[model samples]
Target: MMKKLFSLSCLPLVLVLLSGFMGLQLAEARLHYNYHPKMLFVFGDSYVDTGNTRIDQPGSWKQPYGITFPGKPAGRFSNGRVLTDYIAKYLGLKSPLPYKFRKLIPQQLKYGMNFAYGGTGVFDTSSKNPNMTIQIDFLNQLIKENVYTTSDLYNSVAHVSVAGNDYNFYLSRNGSIEGFPSFIGSVVNQTAINLVRIQKLGVRKIVVGGLQPLGCLPGNTASSSFQKCNSTFNDLVLLHNNLLNQAVTKLNRQSKDNSTFVVVDLYDSFMSVLNHPSTNNIKEPFKPCCVGVGREYNCGSVENNVNKYTVCESPTSAFFWDLLHPSQAGWHAVYNKLQTTNAFQQIRY
Candidate 1:
C-alpha cells in the first residue's frame, strides 16, 4: 500500500491535486499587474540557454541536438527549442540572441540577450562556463557601454534559471547529505540575491524559475528504471522551491517601484506533464529519448569518427531528451501547461 502511494505512474493522489493549486497560487501571489515588456534578458543555466556555450566543445553544438527544429545542431541543448524560446514566443518576440552572437548580429540585440550557458549554476561547477553572477556581470558591462539604453532596461523582462548544478557540484565534492539542508538554504539565499541584483539593474520584471523535480530527472530516475522518483530527493526540491517562493515574495515587497519579482514554478509544470503525459501527447515522461551507447558516453559523445550515442526515431514523443535536459516537445508540453496557470500574468503583452 505504501509503495502504491509513492508510484509515479499513478502520480500519488496528493501530488496530483497539489500541482494544480500550487500553479494558480504561486503565480497570482508573485505577479504584478498591468505591465508589458518589449524585450527580455536571460541569465543562469541551460534550461533557458539558446547556445551561449562554446561551439568547439561537445554539447548543444553537436549533431542530433537541434535536429527537430533547425534540421541540425544549433546549440540548443534540446532536439529543438527550450524554455527561453517558448517564453519569448509567449511574449510575441523572437527568441533572444545569445551573448556570444552579439558581435555577429548587432541589430538583433534589441530583442534581448541570453547570457545563460549550459552546465552553469549560481556558484561555480565542474563546467568552466561563467557562473550566474558572471553572466549578469557581462550584462552590466554591456549596459555601461550604452549598448542597452535606459529605455531598453525599463522595457525588458529578465528570466533566470538556476536548475540544480550547485547541488550536483556539492555532492560531487562529497557534501554530506546531513548537511544538505543548510546548503540548500545558501543556494536559495544566493539566488534571491541574484534576483535582487537583476532588479537593481533596472529590469522592470524578473522571473526566476523554481528548481524542477531533481529526483525525477533521468540521471536519478535511471536508478528506478525510470519508474519512480526518489521521494527523498523530491522532498528537498520542495524545500528549495518553498524557500525560493518566500524569497520572491519578500523581494516583491522590498523592490523598486514597478520592479516585480516572480518565481516561475517550473516544478509544478514539469510534474503535471510527467504525471499525465497523455494529456500533452508525450509517451515516455521519465525515460530520455537520447542516451550514450555506454555508461561513460553521453547523448552528444563522439569518438574516433564514430557516434557514441543513440537518438530516438521521433524525439517529439519523448519528454526527456538526455540525462539532464528535456526534448523540445517536452518543453512545449511544459509551456502549454504554463499558459493555463496564472504565472505569466506579469507579462501583460
Candidate 2:
C-alpha cells in the first residue's frame, strides 16, 4: 500500500514535467503565443493613417480611396486598408480607431488609438496638420484623463510610421541636394527621440518604420515611364535606414529591460516586391493603379461631378494605388514579406 501511494505521487510529478516539456515544444513552434498586446498605438503620417484626416481632405475623403475595402471613401489614404490594418490583423486585434473618431465610438477605445495624420511628419509639413510631437501630446492628454490605465499602456505596442514626408517637404522647399545627408541625420535623430519618449510613456514595445524606397514610388518613377527606380534616391534612403538601425540598437542596449524597439524594414520589403513582382502576383509593379488625367490632378480628383483621375481595371494587379501610396493588394504583399522577418516577433511580449 505504501509503495502504491508513493507511485501515485510520482505519477503527478511526472505528468507535470511532461506537460511543461510539451509547452516548451509548443512555444518553440509558435513564438508569438505569449506576446499578445492588448492594444496598439499608431503615430506619424499617411502610410499608417486610417481616417484621421478630415472629411474635407481631398486625398482620403473622396472616391476610389477606400473603394477596395469599404466600397466608398472612408478617409483611408489607400484604396483599402493600409499598413496599420494589416499589422493590427496580425496581432489578433481590430484596427484601432482614429483619434478623430475615438470620441464618436467610445466602445472601440479598448483596442487603442491612432494619432497618425495624413501628410504630417516629425516636423511641420506643408499640410498644416499636427506634427508627431503634438500627436504624442494627444496621447498624453488621454493618459492624464485616465482614458488609459497604466496596465493598458504596459500591454500596448506603439507603431510609428515616418515615411519620408519630411524629406518630400524639404525637397519641395528647395533643400540642397548636398545638404541632404545632414537633413537625414536630423530626421533620424528626432525619430530616435520620439521612440524613446514613447517608451517612457509606458509602451512595452515600439516599432519605427524604416523609410521605403522613395525612388520606387510611382511619383518618382513617372519620369522613367514607371520602368525603373532611381538608384540615387534609393541610396539616400539606405543612409536613412542605416542611421535608424544604429539608433535602435543603441536604444535597446541602453534599456535595462528586454529589447524595447524594432524597425520595420520598409526599404527591403518594397525592393523585394518591386524587384520580384511575379512572386508577389503583382503584374505592373512600377505602374500605379490610379493616376491623374493631368499634372494638376491626382487620384480621387473630382470637379463638377467629373472625375479627373482614372483607375485601372484591376487595382489588385498594380503595386501602387496612386503616386505615393500602395494599393490594397500591394500592402498585403508587403505584409507577407514583413512576416518572414523578425520585426513582428520582436514586438511580441
Candidate number achieving the greatest TM-score relative to the actual structure: 2
After superposition, candidate 2 runs with Cα above 4 Å error: 1-32
List runs of model 1 lying over 4 Å from the truth. 1-35, 256-259
Q: Write the per-residue lDDT of candidate 1 for residues 111-164, one digit (tens) a residue.
A: 999999988898888456999999999999999999998899988999999899
**Cα lDDT computed for each candidate against the true fold:** 0.88, 0.91
- Model 2 earns a TM-score of 0.91
Q: What range of 10 consecutive residues in model 2 has the weakest lDDT sum?
A: 27-36
Q: How accurate is candidate 1 locally (lDDT)?
A: 0.88
- Cα displacement (Å) at residue 184, model 1: 0.7
lDDT string, candidate 2, 1-349, tens digits: 9999999989989999999999999987686556699999999999999988888777888888988988898888888989999999988899999999878999999999999999998988945579999999999999999999899999999999999999998998875567899999999999999999999899989999999999899998999999999888999999999999999999999997747899989999989999899998999999999888999999988889999999999998889999999998999999999998987667665
Candidate 1: lDDT of 72? 88
Distance from true position, residue 114, model 2, in Å? 0.5
lDDT (0-100) at residue 236 of candidate 2?
96
